[model samples]
Target: MKKDKPKYKQIIDAAIIVIAENGYHQSQVSKIAKQAGVADGTIYLYFKNKEDILISVFEEKMEVFVENLQQIIEIDASASEKLFKMIENHFSVLASDHHLATVTQLELRQSNLALRLRINTILKNYLILLDSILREGIENGEFEQIIDIRLARQMIFGTIDETTTTWVMNEYKYNLVDLTPKVHRLLLNAIKA
Candidate 1:
């Protein structure tokens, strides 16, 4: 697949930086090419246009993100433990990469409706994993059976997403990963049986 090609990875990485630095509307394909160390034409070979590059950037990174979450799911632990780890993992990934954090939390949200839909489709896999954790918690009597799984899922994801967005908006002055414990505890309390 073209994704395995070095240029593809380079372009994706470059696009993240470029998008984060330059708003998606302001980010030009040539700037991305320059950041990727390739000719502008090379970008065309892999992407249909600027929008395609943005989507591809999210796709590549989210694939890895979901994969890591899947690994967390496989660990021999209670659903609460898994949820804590997942929250930690999410915070760690963004905190470790400022450019990626800015791109995902800020830049990605500024897209059109169609683009948002495409991004939402990519996000479903992550949500499905979250749902599994919630279901397991209910089945194992770790979470209150009366809890609405869908609302709980939204709350968990929203809290995580909004926390990261706030950190990003604050220019990352605070240690985001440090909030993991408190965030985990709050979510845990909300769902615990």
Candidate 2:
């Protein structure tokens, strides 16, 4: 219900900036409220606490991310092309939004075990998309028949995740999006038939 409200998105975007700037541990609810231009008490109406805000931020961003990926994959193209587009799109979006890049690639990883578990749960749907791509590749002979789908998904996701994290940690010195081709090629080559 609240997720559909304009204020909900406002708080989520505000939480990203606050958490990115202050680090999640140091980001206070009041800071997020100020960033969102809402009263601190107003945050509670949408979120239960700071952890809720963090989770919601990830959930909201990933929902959009997965939706975009689904649309990208649905186009009439080979699995390899879809996978390339996935890598390219993922890098481009994060490269364009430094705050989101920092929050997703860095701040989100600093949470506690329970929080990480929840984050992983949210991440499952995204992984399933990757798995579907890999399966398609194998079925169509675009990828090697011997390639293990699960391991391939992990490698693809981990490579992209770590690459973005490194770029964010380095303060975006170079064009992260530029690395997409090379990353995509490397991952594709590993599984190519």
Candidate 3:
């Protein structure tokens, strides 16, 4: 399978930088191939086109996202503490890689409806992780008994997402990780019983 080949990862990583620097619409297969140090035709051996490359990048990154998040969720901590760590993890992961952060926070928002929907489907697993935390919180009396899980998941994801997007759009001029505590506190207050 292409996923097992070195060029597959090479192209995916290259596409992140190409897409981030060039914007999704402007980044071409040739540019991605050049960035990956592969021939333009080599790209086709792995992907159908540019759209496939973008979707693949998102899929790979979000898979890691869910894995890291699940590890945090599995830690033996209170629901509130676990939630805090989860928030910290999301911000830290993005803050560690500027190109990845830029592509995820900005370029992802530019995809057409169909592409966005596909990304959303991949994103559902991450949402379920958040849902688990909320359920734990509510069961343990850390969160409001009346809160709706779906709406709460949206709010938490939106707040963290928007906060990071603004940071990316502003050229990451400030400390994104530094904002995590405040965000955690605000989110905690919103859901706390």
Instruction: State which candidate has the highest lDDT.
Output: 1
Better of 1 and 3 by lDDT: 1
Report the lDDT tens digits of candidate 2 across residue range 33-118.
99999999999999999999999999999997799899987999999999988998899889888999999998888899999999
Q: Model 3 Cα displacement at 8 (Å)?
A: 0.8
lDDT of 1 by residue, 72-100 (tens): 99999999999999999999999999999
Per-model C-alpha RMSD: 0.7, 0.8, 0.7
RMSD of 1: 0.7
Instruction: Give the backbone clash total of model 1.
Output: 0
Which has the higher lDDT value, candidate number 2 or candidate number 3?
A: 3
Error of 3 at 63 (Å): 1.0
Give the Cα error of residue 45 in candidate 2, in Å.
0.2
Clashes of 2: 0
